[model samples]
Target: MHRTYSMRQSRAPTASQIENPPPPPSSTKGGRLFGRSNFGHAFRKGTAGAFGPDLAKKLSQLVKMEKNVMRSMELVGRERMEVAQQLSLWGEGCDEDVSDVTDKLGVLIYEIGELEDQFVDRYDQYRVTIKSIRNIEASVQPSRDRKQKITDQIAQLKYKEPNSPRIVVLEQELVRAEAESLVAEAQLSNITREKLKAAFTYQFDALREHCEKTAIIAGYGKHLLELVDDTPVTPGESRPAYDGYEASKAIIQDCEDALTNWVSGHAQVSSKLSTRARTLSQRRKNNASKRGEGVDLAGQDQPMKGDRDSWVAATEHGEIYQHGQDEDEEEEEEEAEGEHEETNGESGGGLSLMQRIGLQSKE
Candidate 1:
């Protein structure tokens, strides 16, 4: 049999509740007709952050607000189920098509209410996790206060009695307090990160399942709407007798089956990011890949000046060698021309004009 969960009334315990019992959402409500007024919420809102240690006040307020939200959701779920029952009652005297459809819709809407109740339970899981953080914050506050108080005592003693032996004792106490505070701070950091992640993970998962199931119910409801004959008929002639009982039942059964079989892996809807988001994601991936490569490649990728220096040094060495060769060739040609001029006896001196010019330039 399909499970038809309600806002668990004050009746005999079900087998499921007996095994791993949790408080029903009904336990959180005011039991009165209209529930509590906003006055209680306003009073709580004004006072939540007014007490407690300064470090914990904000988180304490957040915890208080979450409680308010849970109570509100509980009220909403309870009222929704009532509305569903009223819908079925209103349709009891209508046509057969309207009657069956409204009854089936009531079932689905009641399921939504039940799901909301379940959501409140799961939401409490997140809220409880947050309260742990607030508790830790409150616990750590004492260590901070002790440390500050000891430091102040040491400062006052230094001014009144510089050589007081009690200053040494107080300083030692201050050191111990600081060490304890350090440990507390570290624990606070680690637990805060861990619980924050876990809390949100539970919340988003429940939300996804709830939304998907609601949409499935709506789709089936639309299918049920098709059974109604909207086409206009003659005033004197009545329309054919309605005979969509089996079809509507089949649709409702199909909806029940779909809801029963649904899972995260079988989810049909998907979310798409914007083009800019995709681009940024790709860029981050590229950066991560580049970082993963070895250090040698990373060094080559960097804009190092060593490469330019190495090339410049090689070019300078080549230029110096070529310049020396050219100088040697000029000296050899000058010697040969001097000999030729001497052998030809074409000048008064044995030196050629080129040699004389070279010597004059050197001088």
Candidate 2:
């Protein structure tokens, strides 16, 4: 009968043959191999056998679509990796650009800070200057007003009639007012000049002394100290006064007091010098009087005309006469006396009446 052999009776496989079986013949229907010991073949056959031909064809198409989708995913992953690398490079460039910008910003901030400091310093200086200007204006305002008033008074007086009875009195009043105004203006000018000089001198002396001390302390030598020390040294003299800054009113009274004292001291010195000169001139006159005392004007006995002439000649010549009997001396004295008298007459004749009156008044 058509009975198949049993598995044990078919053939006994060798040990190597059992371990490694021969490849099975391929099947054309399902594109699979049969009688294969491989698990891949069984898996495919199971899948194909479980479904019909139409279903298997649809599954195969689905698997092919999955493979295409996986390939596309791989391509997308590669493009993402390239894009990430480009982004990393751009980030590095951006970091460098940010660093440069940060440095520039820091420098700009520093410049702005310095400019702010300068602006503050300049503003303080401007404020001080404006204050000083205000103080100066205040100081001169009263004087300017007085001068304007005096000028108006003088102008009004000038319009009066030339020969009016009140004209002379008005003219005198105007002159006095003008003189007072001039004195006031001069005093103001002197005050301003002196105050300025004092302020400048005070500041200069302080700075110079400071420089001198610094130079000495730093061992810059005595020469540098001397060069920097420009303070004027006056022996046996009072120190000059300083009114302080013009903007300050506190020291103005002290300044005025000092100026008055200084003026008084100057006047005292001038008076002393003038007195000394006058004393010297008086002493000279006294010596001349002593020299003239030797001349005998009131004599009890009258001398002969010839002897009198000789004696007068000797006196006019400013010669001390030794009572000697020499003829040459007497003759020379007589000639000199005649010449002196003639010269005196010529000079006296030339004097005007006013000069003669002045001379008589002095006598």
How well is each residue in 1-363 modelled by candidate 2, as lDDT tens digits?
110110111223323224434222111111112211244333443442132222123333333233233223333433433443343333334333332222222222222222222222222322223222222223333434555566665566567544556656656766765654454444444444644465454334323332332232233222222322235668886434432222111122232233223221122212245888999999999999888765333342223234211212333222112222122234335534444433231110111112211221121
Clashes of 2: 0
Cα displacement (Å) at residue 194, model 2 = 11
TM-score result, candidate 2: 0.21
lDDT of 1 by residue, 167-268 (tens): 999988998889877766766666678778977876776677778888988898899888887778788977778888677667776776676567777778
Candidates in order, TM-scores: namely 0.68, 0.21
TM-score of 1: 0.68
Specify the poorest-scoring 10-residue window by lDDT in model 1.
Answer: 345-354
The parts of candidate 1 lying over 4 Å away from their true place are 1-35, 271-363
Instruction: Say what the RMSD of model 1 is.
Output: 39.9
